[model samples]
Target: MTKIAVLGAGSWGTALANTMAKNEQDVTIWSHKAEQAKEIALKKTNARYLPGASLDSNLKATDDMALAVQGADIVLLVVPTKAIRQVAKQLGTILEEKRQQVVLAHAAKGLEQKTHLRISQMIEAEIPAEFVTGLAVISGPSHAEDVVKGDLTAISIGSTDDAAARLLQAALANEHFRPYTNSDLVGSELGGALKNIIAIGSGMLIGKGYGANAQAALLTRGLVEIREVGKALGAEGETFLGLAGIGDLIVTGMSPNSRNYRAGVALASGKPLAQVEEEMGMVIEGVNTIKAVVDFEEEFDLDLPITRTLYQVIYEGKTIDQGINDLMTRPLKAED
Candidate 1:
């Protein structure tokens, strides 16, 4: 994987593209906005996403989808969940026109709203087998801010096919960036998407004047719910303890750099989901993830109290206090 195209010029996409460029890989990052792409080319800094961090001069940027996907050995999808389908569909159109078989990997971390599909699942649904030779998901606790700053960050790449995952692991791994491989796509994807929900809750807790004690309880019980849901979806029990599960949960739920966490603060301040997301200038995956989760719980008959409560607060116009009270006053049960 020397020739790589990173879709989306958001914080994560820019960071990963620079990382690969530093490792001496031929990289091009695609941005939907032409000005952002031009800025990346001329200025060599994505100030909107990564302020003050210099991008690698070797890295390329483009707004043309055909140019970005054409002849690339690997394509890394880094857009938010809402944009995945349109991007994948558009990528598929470009990919089908080419004869080269490409490996597709995604770093996006949320389920599709209406389809409730994982990012890889959505990609596969869009791209035919003739174009996409392999699919893998790169997830875990790698925050874009920390990653670009050269902080030591460990994450996981999961795939049913070992060759695809290993290819990405080797291509992405560096001294400061650790990429662990796993086979549980269900666990990995679910864990990655679901943690944002809890991250929003963590932020709401901070904004509501809740202490570390509450956050700890939330994280622990949240882990249990995550594991339960993963198992219900055919995920391995131990996957929850791995990088994609607990590792992702810890980082997204606690980190200030997380858009989901920041959105939680706004939600706690009695702001609407739309306003919070608009003000943050980024997609808050947790809000959308909660709606998908709420849909899944009803369709699958699963119990997700924290997720449900957050949905109530955000969608049903219920107060945060009332939602928390509902959670605390629930019936007692075993720690299992």
Candidate 2:
């Protein structure tokens, strides 16, 4: 059995741990809070994160970082983007103390603020190279709510190392959960991260009482913007057309299950960004990601109306109505 350690006890992390354990892998989930860990391990449920869901009996939970990764062959990180550096630093320290190496994969989907580094880049910078066999990212349209319920899901395992990607694929895939290997790590990571911005926009459309026509337009244009940004970052255009790209965008954009999408809905209801985020009780990656993408747009001098509008609305105190008008008033251009 592949000994897997999942870092984070949130909805996504807990769901992933449960799925892998059900697949018969030896899986351990680690949470920073001892109480949360005890709840999952002893109570067989993570009510705070995955309420109404039961964990697999075989899955283990712990608060100690060292204990979770002691015999881990594959370390899958599912923490928020903001926490990646800290978690990677802690994991690196534990690996160094044990003198052990393992393949590392992250499922977080956002770039770091100011630095604008992707999740994989953040992990690589913090983790010691000698303690890592390879690095990969698992992403696509799989939502935690659905995945934990045994719904059929498919995701992309992206890595520059073919062996590393294939290893993760073999360790995670099952009848209900399928993973496809892809070498376009850049595209895979960018696609998932960038789509959250559009998902927020999608939610705003519904909240604002817009019809299906507006949503179709938003998605189409949003994808064009995503592809453009991915291209500037050295990602393959074709990857944006695949599961990690369009697939993730569609689900996260359309589904109410997406935190970012829900964030948009709340924003459209005229709630302040702080209040919306505080009540949601989850890290809305798109809010932070909007800043990063806007930075990218200015640096590259690219036109991303949706992203810029979001930044203005969230950070600059611009009203949602004005933001929409700003987008609608932009100079006409042919669709790429």
Candidate 3:
């Protein structure tokens, strides 16, 4: 069985780890919080993030990074974007000492706030090259809430390294979980990250009492915006047409389970951004993604009306109605 180390103990991390363990892999999950690690190990439940779901009894949990990663064949990163570099650095030090070569895969979706780097780029910047056998990104329409309930979930495992991608595909796939391999890492990563912004827009529309027509229009336009920006950033346009692109957008943009979408609804309900985030008790990646993508648009001169308008509503204290007005009033152009 493949030995796997899953970093981060949030809902996504725990769900993925439990899946691996149930697949008969030797899996260990790391949580920085000692009490959480103990709880998962002893109680077989991650109560804080993944409520009511029973983890595999065989799964192990640890607060010690070295213990979690020891003899691991694949190191899966499921941490938030903000913690990518820090976790990579720690993993690098441990791997260098162990002299282990392992596949690296990240499931997190978001760009770095300051550097605007993708999750893989941030990991590469901190990790020593010799210890990494391959790098892949896992993203698609799957949600932890559904996945744990044995819902059929399909996701793309993107990597330039074909063998590594196939390896992950084999290790993670089951009757309920399907993993497809893709070579367009940039497109895959961008598709996942960028869609969160649109999902927030979707939530805002719901909050403003808009119906399906508006959501359909928003998603179509948002997809175009994502494709254009991704192309400018060196991703293949066609990648956005696939699961990593439209599939993910559809699920996240429409689902009440999506944190970003909920964040938007809360924002529209007149709650301050800080208050909404506090109430949610999760990272809400779209908020940070907006800041990062706005910087990218400014630097590259890309036109992203939805993202731009959300920025104003979120950070500039503009009302949701005013933001909608601005988007509707933009100079008319042919649908790109």
Candidate 4:
């Protein structure tokens, strides 16, 4: 059996642990809280993040990072993006006794708010390249709640190393949960990160009583903005049109279960972003990713009007009506 260590016991992390254990892999999950570990180990449940779901018997939970990762063939980092650096730092100290040949995969999606670095870059910075072996980011239309319920879903696995990517593809692909492999790490990672911002826009549209036409327009235009940034960053344009890009946008933007979408709806309902997060009890990645997109636009000289307006609405106290009007008034140009 392939030994896999999954860091973080949040919903998505727990869902992945369940998936891997279902595959008969030896899966261990690390949680910072001893109580969380105890819940999973004893009751086989992660009530806080994934209620009503029973974890697989093959899955073990631990608070000790070293014990969770000890002699694992693969390590899956599933923590929130903000917690990634600290987790990687701790892993560095604990994995010193382990061989450097382990495959590293992460499921988190977002760029660092202050540094504008993607999760992959942050991991590369914190973990040695040799031990890193290769990196894979598994993402797409996946909701932790849906996965825990055993609903069918599809995701993309991206890496520069084709062989390593294929290895992950084999590990994660299943009858209900499919995994597609791609080499465009930049496009896949950026697509996953940027879709959260668009999902916020979608929620705002719904909150404001916009019909399906407006929602479709926002989703399409959002893809355009994502593609523009991807192009500026040298990502393959076609990748944006694929599973990790448009597919992810459609699911996240439309689904109420998406944390980003919920965050947007809360914002549209006149609640402060912080208050919304407090009520939701989960990390809304789009809130931070929107700031990162704003920074990227300024740094790269990209004209992402949708992103700009969204940023203003979220950060600069602009009204939703004002933001929509600003987007509507942009000079007409030929459709690309």
- Clashes counted in candidate 4 amount to 0
Candidate 3 lDDT over residue span 63-143, tens digit each: 999999999999999999989999999999999999999999999999998788999999998998899999999999989
Taking all chains together, the TM-score of candidate 2 against the true structure is: 0.98
Model 4 quality (TM-score): 0.97
Model 2 C-alpha lDDT per residue in residues 1-336, reported as the tens digit of each score:
899999999999999999999989999999999999999999999998888998899999999989999989999999999999999999999999999999999999999998999998899899999999989999899899999999999999889989989888987888999999999999999999999999999999899999889888898899999999999999999998889999999999999999999999999998988999899999999888888899889889898989888888888898888988889998988878
The models' CA-based lDDT, in order, is 0.88, 0.92, 0.92, 0.88
Candidate 2 runs further than 4 Å off: none
How would you encode candidate 4's per-residue C-alpha lDDT over 281-330 as one tens digit per residue?
A: 98889888888888779889988888899999998999998999988888
Candidate 2: clashing pairs of residues: none
TM-score of each: 0.97, 0.98, 0.98, 0.97
- In terms of lDDT, which candidate is stronger, 3 or 4? 3
